[model samples]
Target chain A: MSIVGEIIISALLLVGAGFMLVGSLGLARLADPLQRLHGPTKATTVGIGAILMASMLYQFVGHDKISFHEFLIALFLFITAPISAHLLAKAYLHMNRTDRE
Target chain B: MISIALAVSAAAISFSVVLNLWRLLVGPTPTDRLLALDTMVINSIALIILFGMSYATFIYFEAALLFAMVAFVATISFCKYLLRGNVIE
Candidate 1:
């Protein structure tokens, strides 16, 4: 790959890593569970997508191989995250309901 | 070109993470925490993919995939437990 390409890839990686770090920090420091969900669902999803795109670009440019594994992971994550969040939130609501009864 | 792209993407992702952190800090309930955790796992998967590209290796992809599977299962179980008071129930 050309030097410019390499530089771009590195930049993407760094940015992606920064996002991941921020997301984790948010996860750890959030004050309440309901509010905490906002951080990971939105920011983290975008952050992860950026990183994955960078990786795919790097592999495509350098190795000449269209690595689809990353895509598979991304797909799995995209499909499952919302479901998990929904389930958890539902559970929480159910518990609250029971407690109030 | 590739490096520059990667770097830029990484930086953007980092900014998002920071924003998420702000939400986590102010969340008002336990469900919010779990939601943050779910987002964290997704971000981790992306980070793993970036690592795979940086190192020019495929092993990281496998690990990332595995982590996703485990995270999904764990989340489901936890949610079930919370709702019914037992995974079996």
Candidate 2:
């Protein structure tokens, strides 16, 4: 890989991982479960997205072969993350109401 | 430089996971625990992808795909049980 390509891959990976760490930090530090939901869904989505994009580039530029399968995982995560977060939030609210009664 | 970045990324993510674990154990409510679990799932996925990058192999792709599916199902089921009072009902 050229220096440019290498730098791009490294940048992507570092940014992705940094976001991942930050998301988890939010998860740990946030005051409420509902507030915590924002961390993984939003930040981790971008984090993993960046990481996947970096992987795709590394495979194509370093090995001279283009790989598209990485996109599948990214797509799946993007689609499912919101649904799960929604469900979890609803459940939290539902149970919280019951627990108080 | 790439090696250093990868190492640092991995360390950061691992520390994040540890932080998530702490939250999971200290959960004041089940929802908190569930959220922690969900966060861990995503964090692990990030870690696996990074591992794949470091090794320059695509094999981790399958594991990552399967984990995403399983995590979704697990989250939905956990929520379903709470919402409906039964997992399948």
Off by over 4 Å in 1: A28-31, B1-40
TM-score of chain B of each: 0.83, 0.95
What is the C-alpha lDDT profile of model 2 across A32-82, one tens digit per residue? 789988998899889889988988898888888787767998999899989
Query: What pairs collide in candidate 2?
Result: none
- Cα-based lDDT for every prediction: 0.67, 0.87
Tens-digit lDDT track of model 2 for B1-84:
667777888898899889889989999778788888887888898889888878878788899989989988998998898899
Local error of candidate 1 at residue B17 (angstroms): 11
User: Each prediction's interface RMSD?
Assistant: 4.5, 1.0
